[model samples]
Target: MELSGKGGGSRERAALGLTFVLRHGRRTGLASAARLLQLFDVKIHHIETRPARMPQNPAEDLEFFVKCEVLDCKVSSLISSLKKVAEDVEGNREGKAPWFPTKIRDLDRCHHLVTKYNPDLDCEHPGYTDPEYRKRRAFIADLAFNFRHGDPLPRVEYTPQEIATWREVYEKLSSLYPTHACKQYLDAFHELEKYCGYQADSIPQLHEVSAFLSERTGFTLRPAAGLLSARDFLAGFAFRVFQSTQYIRHSSSPMHSPEPDCCHELLGHVPMLADKEFALFSQDIGLASLGASDLDIEKLSAVSMHLILLGRYRTNERTNKAYGAGLLSSYGELMYALSNKPEYKPFDPDVMVIQPYQDQNFQQIYFVAEHFEEAKSQFQKYAMKIKKPFPLHYDPFTCTVEVLDSPQKIKKITSHVKEELKSFEKLS
Candidate 1:
């Protein structure tokens, strides 16, 4: 249970797994890496090289994932040696610890946690000047602010005006789904309508939809008062939890809102989260954030927001479709992203982490992936670049993070993996 070595004192027992990314400028990324490992008492366990391209360099470079064992006392020296040849080094033994949810009830602790991206309505907000609307908004927001994990999800009785707004947005989007939405989204949407009461006449209640989604994807929704801090929102995915807004957007701007409203959450995100790969892609972002530093978190925003912004557009005659919640929620932006007008760039995490985002405008460029699996694979490679000090694993059955910091933890997890492989072998 101890990771106090700092790579000193005892050299006999502790074993560490290390992965480092080589700098692009150094063409000798592979050769130099192997040479560095031999310089220390390091025993290489497993090694892999994946050819990947970055925006800065047009040439392909190798991504080295090295699993190695070093004398407990010499771990630091090995890391230092690797750093001389590698641009960044990641070892699973040490780093910062961030708060994480380990049980279903533990989520209650985050109920009132606000990472406000302007928690209060800005003047530019559509209903900012309407006191009556503000009152209604606050009433719904309170349900989320006061929410506890086990409490019934707050149900809203839509007024005629709210119904009218819902009808307008629903009709517009439903008509386009046949043409613009991905197949997985359409399938999820129909099931939601059939089982969870998704329709034009009334807004679907969070409780029913939450139950429907949880049964399908192990993902459930909790209400959020408004825009959650990127960090808080992203954290939910680690536990298959999604923080959704309960209030509908202002009726005047039913088609567009500067912030996420219930319209966006239910229409844009809910159905998409039901897709298994998309859900896993979302969890990858959360998994990457555990024990991540502030600067690392700031950079993660590039992919986290894109969880709903990712799209797949084929250059061939096949239809281009939108998979992310961000684009699917907006009628106009969805059209723009799938159209021929905007620049299409492959979803490169190294490039996207630095891309700028605006709450008010449509993204000028859309990141394209052939499917969620490709996006998931590429993003995971990018996630390793996140500076989490130790490795983490999420156990869905228990709804907790299993930190692999001690030998006991490592052995316990390896046994689980071995059991999984055994079952898979029989199926195969």
Candidate 2:
């Protein structure tokens, strides 16, 4: 849960990158490339890749696409490898065991800790404490379960130790955390993990985890980290009321229904958070949201796009790598992001925050962070712009997308039209 010395030994571990294979033009090296990637523990699961042009734009760059039939075995193996990487990082962090605090009472204490110990970290609390705020939070929380868990289940209880562990992470993370912009993100994990306490069966390894979403809570069954929980909150922002369907689609399925399952949530997003540099980078961006205007929120959405696509865009070896959970879990996305074919732009948080995103398909454009520190410094310099105790604009749709009374037939039709087009495209 609170990995201490992840990426231990600082052997200069690299982020993951896209792996492009010209399925049509160059089959010659495809096998070797795939083999080499396998040697690197990278996976190549897509079986039906092809070069295709954009539907609307005739002149847009062509892209390689795939709809591989992934067996549970292969997926499980991929997950094992990824989990190994994540575990290695976490083990390393624990070895370091940086002096993390156990608890905090308020934002002032939170601030002092951040400035004193983690000046790089940012925190936010989306002023959701008013009655209306409580109602909204409850509504979102309820909807999140509805879509995922399917019933008003009994309250889940946390063990004294598990509760204490979460309290410890929350306290340490909250201290010096700067923006409430990312509160929703953090809360998503907190909320789900709270569900874990009910399902726990006296397992100690699982006990150390405080906030865990059960299989009932609209995700594939797996233990995920808080950051991934936050990313899942965003990906499923609009689908908070229905159960995360277990029926995975085959290559024959009409649309890319890569269910936003626990594998994607935990495997894709959480490891990067294990990286101190990336964790602080995210805190900085989240802090930017506190003072963000509606325009800033809009721009921040673009920033999310930039981060998602960067998981794939391959530039320099460093620039080519990604820590995003989305790319980590999917063979298709992992391949595309590591591939050099896609255009890679310089990482620019501000410009990215303003860039328009296509919610219907994979990103065609991406920005590359110059260095982890560049992202960190960017947040540090702009931390002031991030407002404290930020306010949120309400979207009736965002608030209630999953709760509308609609039959499965109509719901499927509407999802195909609006959500299915968008869901897998955006990686949290």
Off by over 4 Å in 2: 1-259, 312-319, 382-428
Taken over the whole model, the C-alpha lDDT of each candidate is 0.75, 0.35
Rate residue 92 of model 1 by lDDT. Answer: 63
> What are the models' TM-scores?
0.75, 0.35
* Per-candidate clashes, comma-separated: 2, 42
Residue 294, candidate 2: how far off, in angstroms? Answer: 2.1
Give a tens-digit lDDT track for model 1, residues 1-428: 34545644654644565766665634765676776667675787777664432214536455576766776677777777778776547666523355556666766645433323322447777787778788988788777867887888888887899888889999998888888888889999999889888999998888888899889888999988777666677788788889988777788888897778778889998998898877877788877876677678888877666656555644345557887787888888888877779888887878777778766888877778766577778878888777655788888887888778888888999999999999999999
How far does residue 226 in candidate 2 sit from its true spot (Å)? 16
lDDT of 1: 0.75
Model 2 Cα lDDT, one tens digit per residue, 302-341? 6654563243223344435554544454545445655666
